[model samples]
Target: MSDTYRALTRKYRPTSFEDIVSQDHVSNTIKNAIKQNRLSHAYMFCGPRGVGKTTMARVLARTINEIDSSIDGESLNQTLNIVEMDAASNNKVDDVHHLRESVRIPPQNGKYKVFIVDEVHMLSKAAFNALLKTLEEPPEHAIFIFATTEPHKVLPTILSRVQRFDFKRISVDEIVQRLRKISLDEDISIDEESLHVIAKKADGALRDALGLMDQAIAFCGDTITHNELLQALNVVGTDRLFEFMECVKDHDADRGLELINTLLQEGYDIQEYLIGLTEHLRNLYIAHETSKLYLVEASEETKKRYQQTAGDFSRDDLMRMLHIISEAQIKLKDASQPRIQFEITLLKLIHMERSEQLSELLAGLQELKKNSGNFVAPSQNGSTQKEVKPEPEEQAEKVSEPVDETESTEENLEPQPLNPSTDSEAVGSDGSSPGPKESEIEVEAEAEVDTQIEEEEDDDFDIGAPALITTLARKARASVQSEKQKQTAPSNGAPTETSSEKDLPEKITTEYVQEIWVEYLESLKGDFPMLLHLQMERTKVKKVKGGELHLECDNSFAQKMLDEQSTDLQFKLKEFTGSVLRFNISVGEIDEKDKPMSVYERFKQIQQKDPIIRDIVEIFGAELEY
Candidate 1:
């Protein structure tokens, strides 16, 4: 054993440009500049720590002065021509003043006196200003080189005066290659997995990797295994992360809790464990999305494991899991009991319902809607009836559930008409009159069924088959009755005698026009596009005189939309009142009282129209906000 032993980081420090690892871009560029004699007076080398920034600066300083390491100590610590300064220790204006005075003296050995400043960003503002003049125009024999982990902190004034070179973090593979070479040169017997763990723990910093290797050698002697290295480094094992993810996939909350207990009991840092778990999830996501195992920084066997586990979760579920894990990572720092918080976080992942794609959810809803239309309702006698097409006059006679025979009168069976003032019905293409009010009832029934399913969704409960069947059956019945009513109404071919034929209105009154306007909106409920129906809902009947029907709206956009549909509306009115009335739609101040009610207010008002909506909303344990 050596008493004056050197740490691996300091022992393996590169002496020349060629000896630096994974910095070819910077080394090549600087070498070309030196060959061309185009060296900038001030150069800034910046990047993450241990990625060879300061090392590159030192090499550049040595190269500029053409100092041969064989003669001039390889460490460059004993050189007279090269000056090294750490800005962190001496960052005052007086330090810059001292440096300014030192640079005035010519080099004693080399043509150029090179100055290397590390952690340059730590300099005070006053120091940077004092150094800025020296940087802008230094003596022909003096050269300044700056290295910093954070270049953004340096003043823009100082940055503009220098030629900047950015260094990148060494990749895991490169770090592993470097570690392997060092291990072989030093006669260390270590497994490949242990080397990989050290490289990954370095996080793209070769110096850190070397330091970790030194620690491993001290703890595990000359021989190192993967398990021993993990313990020496205090890192969580990858197996624990893999097992936790499996528990999440299978929704095994109990197993997830057990994994958390084991992790804490093993003396793993809660934050470090979370970070490793997050990385494990990221690997799974990459495998699932790109199917490129190389994108994940793991061994071949671990990549294969990721590939296999990737199939268990969809991309949407993986994204959600990542989001939850990221939030927990942030919240873990403030948690009073980190173990409890970690356990809760794992349980949340295990209990999380996998997210379904939007298209899949919509497809499911459509399939349910289609199936609901065919569902049969049970009668009072507990017998199910198969719905069949009805005869013309007997259309309204068929009902879904049994009722008292006495209540089955003509008045009870007839659909309440919206247009009580007009006798003529809007004739359809098939020669029968379509009942506008009946279609409105059907629309309301459909809305009720939709709300019921929504209520179930809000409660986080699956739409029960029984509840859906009942709601769908009611909707189906209403739809069928409306369809039959439209088909069975008296057509132009049939000259049926009616009270309207005997007593036709001689004149169009405001009241008559208003009633007809409501029926027009009701008629649009099912047959027309919703925009037209909704627009008509917002209109107010302002006036009706001398064959002119005036409608008012709040905005010009609404007025324009109504104006476009006015001609068709006029035709509808002619069919009802047998009058060619002109529609005058204009932007005007409509009274607040005339505006349509909000959905919640309307539902409350129309509860009597369909009490089942209120019942379903309550029974499903959801508030009908709309």
Candidate 2:
């Protein structure tokens, strides 16, 4: 068989530093060190697998020995001075000592005796100790070069004695360029798109790229296409991934799940599918901010797919989906069924929608209001303002009208009266008052009724308050109504008006004040639903004046919770109601007799109710205590 059948990767391995792909900086530094004759006794090369760690180590060894004709600027069959050792197999202290003893002797013919220790991290602890002394100080002609996929496993003492160079994962473009060069040299034909697929599959490892290329060439013959590469690799193409992403964008979980199932049936690994999906989303996220497609790997076709998908999703939605999928990936390892986990995660991604943060929601509401048109308040001169009143004839007609039987029946079916005394008199089955004790019950009932009424009136007031307050505040600010009316009035000016009218500020309708106050409270409820549930029953809006909103809660804990969230609360309120409302949180004394049981107490009560859990507890001899 020809050499072409012997895997393109090994056939085209880099023979010199310049021939190495995607690691010029590393290569250049090493080459310069050799030229400067400032070579360190020990050197460590670390990076991901197939990113040229071992290849570079071999090249470095040959380069120091002046074996490559390209580097020495001459064509000659040079004898090798470099000695390559596999530390993985020879990991004993004796092997290390033998190597050390050889290292102490000078090269027989070459300028330097370079010992290339591959997978040096695999050396035993004793072997490492034995090698340390030689590594720290070696013969003038000796050089120790270490290469490993995992540098963390190497002893720090060994690491400290060496010059370390980290090799980065090769980029897709670099891998593609290298692959293209190999294709041209080997007289094989492959499309640019197909090359891109191979490079991406390599995931920044040049060796992997070549290995994949070798597979693709064999599987598809010489003229390989993108589809062929995908088929051979068992990878879902970018188009399919984009299609699934679009389904997610449209919130079509079923469609997304169908696509996932199809891919899985096609023999794609669930883990690899997730990785590809994540990368697809990541590309879109980056594309949303940048027009540069190079930031993420892929061909022109793939880039376009990403840009289109990104346009279909908002930044917030995409971020949320990424988070959910990432979390699901973490859970997949321990899951009983990984496919189910993946499907569930995909469903979540599809169903995921953008939800504005509290601040953003408020801001959006405020913006909407600003664009709705200016608010106008009523004029101070009530007589001058247009007021709708029924004419005498209309009032007479209304008085003459008779009620229909349906209307009468509807009215008669009204809710039964809540007679405070009668309701309070009713005895509970346990012989306790239906309500709290007489004095406490009355106070609590009255407070509850007042709070309810206040809330209702506030809602009614808000509808017209914006326009009314806008007109009133503007007029007051401009002093237009007061100044103009003062000039038109009798020479004594406000002498005719009551002294109380002039002294007392324009009284904002109780309804309008209550409405704004209640709306502010509702806004707070949205941000802290749990806290709101606990406080709403016992909380009351005291007053809203000069943009200051006063509220009373039942205890200091509620007050503190509200206070802690005051800044955010104020911002949200201002956004919702367009009022710079301030909060005054005060604790109110509430009767604690009707307070709900604690969680532990509730657990105990539940155990008493359910036979199953109760039996489990009884069998375990568990004790319940308050």
Q: Per-prediction count of colliding residue pairs? A: 0, 5
* Best TM-score among the predictions, by candidate number: 1
- Our model 1 lands, by Cα RMSD against the true structure, at 17.6
Residue 375 error, candidate 2, Å: 23
Give TM per candidate.
0.61, 0.58
Candidate closest to the true structure, highest lDDT: 1
Positional deviation of 433 in candidate 1, in angstroms? 45
Local distance difference test, candidate 1 = 0.73
Q: Which stretches of candidate 1 lie over 4 Å from their true place?
A: 1-4, 70-75, 289-291, 356-365, 373-626
Clashing residue pairs in candidate 1 are none
What digit string (tens of lDDT, one per residue) describes model 2 on residues 113-215?
A: 8788889999999999988777887888888889999899999999899999999998888888998888988778998888888888888888888888888
Worst lDDT 10-window in candidate 2? 463-472
